[model samples]
Target: MSASTHWLATASIQSVLERGGNAFDAAVAGAFVLHVVEPHLNGPGGDMTGIFATADRPGEPVVLMGQGPAPAAATTEHYRAEGLELVPGAGALASAVPGAVDAWLLLLRDHGTWPLADVLAYAVGYARQGHQILPRVRDTIATVAELFTDHWPSSAAHWMPDGEVPGDDALLRNEPYAAVLDQLVGAAEGTAGGPDPTGTAAGRRTAGIEAARDLWARLVGREAEAFLARPHRHSSGTDHAGVLSAADVEGFRACYEPSATVSFRGHTIAKTGPWGQGPALLLTLAILEGFDDEYLDPSTELGAHTILEAQKLAIADRESYFGDTDVPLGHLLSTEYSAERRRLITESASHEFRPGTVPGHPPFIPPLRVDYTPPAAATGAKTGFAGIGEPTVQPDGETRGDTCHLDVVDRWGNMVSATPSGGWLQSSPLVPALGFCLGTRLQMTWLEDGAPSTLTPGKRPRTTLTPTLVLKDGQAVSALGSPGGDQQDQWQLLYLLRTIVGGYSPQQAIDAPALHTTSIPGSFWPRTWTPGGAVVEDRLGQEVIAGLEARGHVVTRAGDWALGRLSAVVRDPATGQLAAAANPRGVQGYAAGR
Candidate 1:
């Protein structure tokens, strides 16, 4: 299938527009389509993060932080108080107010060229009609189904789309779901439907043409469901976080605003933005400036060695020092890049150390902690570096996690990058319906009883879902992103350095094998894979690995044929040619351009 077949790529977005959807509409449409195509990663049950720059807002870009924050009923004390070690389960506590709807409404309000009902028409249709399950989808279902094993119907339902998870190419359909979408997205625009898609702003009213406007406006509505209901089959409702009196759709924070931005090497970025990590990128860039780029890109031994060292040092500092800049982790130092941080990084890289994971562990986690936490700092800077890191989710279990990354650029010199993710349930499985797969992202936190990232009411867990963009003269040159958990930034940095800076074409950079270094201590979750250099199908061969190993690299094998699928788009300055490439590791990770 063509990459444009999905919506995030501008080719596909433009296709939707040709079929009568605007950028906002196309994004929403693409997301819905993606749910049909790659339900294992995201769906109506999950959330969305979108960055759409309208020609109208040429100067100020629009960013929608669509990902959900912790639910109101969740409390840090609740998890710690339960004596539950590690992450929580996927019960009522794991979910957040469905942010996709709110973000969708916000985007519809601003840049939507068509009616929300119209944009959702395709998604709802696909949900009901069903899409075929590709190898990737089946792989995800087969691997991840076990994590949801305890959740009953959800586990059984999600995997058995076409009689016991079809092998390879299986025809899949969500008829029951399609009916539901028809009802939800088909709600009247105004007077007739129960929902008041209004009050947020005048624009969201979606005031369709006079005749059908009132009808469509009031078409559909959402009533909160029980926190731990059977399982959601569609975008239903969430009863008040704790228990009874149901909360209405209106209670969700539906307003959209610009994201907090940081600049790195002259490029603007957003932390917790269209995807998380605007500051981290800036911090990494700052650290890189202190070194020689050409020297850093030497032998598989010297090159990967330098990056590994730098990756460990910078990532370690982020774990301790990073937090919501507004919330201020007074105990931790500032995440801003500084000469002190650079100096500390240089000093710390000369030695080796493994940061400890949460609870210190029985196997003792070996400091191979996950990297999705807020910005952090290594303890007192005692030289933290290791040859290992996985950034795994329920590792050694053969479990699979779902995630999506897509970048879009309009002909108008505007670009957008967004990554959407949710882990297994909080710590357990709790599916309310069949239509949506609830995210257990809360489990990503350390859950150390009183720790901040733990089960805090209405708080968003930290994530390493970073999106990378390059802008020159305030115009976008390229937008790049991946879905490899913590390794995302690591692989992305390499890609950016070689492709954007070293001047490799988009396709060439994408074809290049990727590497990762988990050499830093995770703030919360356990780190799984080690970092060094990864060869695609032995593409660059053993010589590279041997050289890397000699440099103290673990050189783990990513044998999955397709590993860490990366998608990127590049804009050539002189030619104005728009080129895109999908990493070879992923069958579906192909890029299309017009």
Candidate 2:
């Protein structure tokens, strides 16, 4: 079974699985297709993080550490010298080493059954033979049309041929990206020496995969370095050259690591470490575990209030402590610390940014700017471009430039949940040679010194691309994830509560209305917070919404289906039954299986 944010990706996964590929292979195929079909949401120049449990090791959850660190020259001093206070949200200067391709390739080399050529054929076909452009993709192009035409002409040439934005559902093709894939495949085959005359087939496959990885690093990195080194317009409304070099890209490699886990409702929930925001979900679950089942319900007013409060507390800690530095995760996840944090959740909403005190560790309090107005110089008289950041939910619940998610569970108990994001067409100027842009992941880092998430050379910015894996009875049971920035885990929290605590099935849980608190500091650029703010879908009911508002939550109604874009695939080890569910909100996501 497979579920993904886009129908094409889900269809690709179905085809791969039907062709004797395992969950890993299906996921890789679907992910590459996403880069082609959902270019506004993700691309080859992006980053991704996944958690999976192999069929041979069902009990152990492994995190695919695909997030890249800052470049060696990405120093806070250099950025400050450029007369910048914050990392620009959409430029090469905000790029980390591109890691999504390397990570997916690593997974394919280590665990997949299909060859690289077969896996990439799905994406190559879509990129060369064209796919229907999504309305959102077209809309995003229109929004940034001026930016492309005036400053990033390469982007204008790619997205808007002859200075015209393509209409929705227009057939779009990326021949450059398709050619890039062909080159990778040809290079890999040539370097592998025609299937290795003396070595085994497995040996040849590994060799080919490694050759592809090396070629990607060499080709993409060199082109990106040359393109971004030229001065370009940034979200800050400044023209600055990027700092990422070929060495930065060549030095990074994606690898697997043990997942950070916390037991909740007799289920082991797995996530990436503190380098990403995955641990914040675990911390929220730990805090909520002390509450009664009734309070965990997401349908009622009381349950909504409790969940929002818990998320705020957990996200506060995330803002203060989560990064690529040493974090006191042991104490944060301890029962005593959870109890202490739980005691602070009052009946009413909290308008304050409160991170609990940890022993011998002082919380680094970030600047809390409630309202942000760009300077006239920064705005450049550009109306729509001001305050643009990741495609995340705004304070008023509006969204743009969102992420993509996919989940696959095969009959063999192999399961994977992956969230691929960044490198939106609007992220940076198009790297003309690669037909893609570098991601702005470095915007998650602070320019301020001493913060755990501060922009430091060679250290990863705390990312929000989180995926989840659930295990029960020493066997992997489900893999799930979504694509909201800071709200990623918040939306998934509702799904987890509905399924694990409310006894709702996967589809039932996904169909339910969703809500997330925005009271905490945002991880994106123009970092700000909304005090006592919460955004909820109107389908959650007026009574519940009014109850939250009465409890002092500054609520924003996001229509009936505007909050989450989640999907999941589940397996029952005892019965060998499999199921999949995808969000119906956007009318795009789908689940496929037989």
Misplaced by over 4 Å in model 1 are: 1-14, 89-92, 144-151, 161-163, 191-224, 227-250, 254-275, 296-299, 325-337, 344-397, 423-434, 449-452, 521-544, 560-562, 572-576
The 0-to-1 C-alpha lDDT of every candidate, in the order given, reads 0.49, 0.91
Model 2, range 49-96, lDDT digits (tens) per residue?
Answer: 999999999999999989999999999999988878888888888999
RMSD of 1: 8.3
* Count of steric clashes across candidates, in order: 65, 2
Say which candidate scores most in TM-score.
Answer: 2
Q: What are the per-residue Cα lDDT tens digits for candidate 1 across 1-594?
A: 113224333344557656654445666566556656666555555555654454454335555666566665556565445433444323344455455545655565556666656666676665666556676567655644433343335545555643365677566666644554555444435423333456433333454322132221222113224334443221011111321113422344434556545455456544343124444555555556566666355224456556666666555545543432232322112334344445544312233442212222221223343232312122232111110122433224333454676766555545566666552322223333335545545544555543334445555555556666565555556667776666677767777667545667776766665666645544323333344323323444577667666555655665434345567766655666776777665456656645
Q: How high a TM-score does candidate 2 get?
A: 0.98
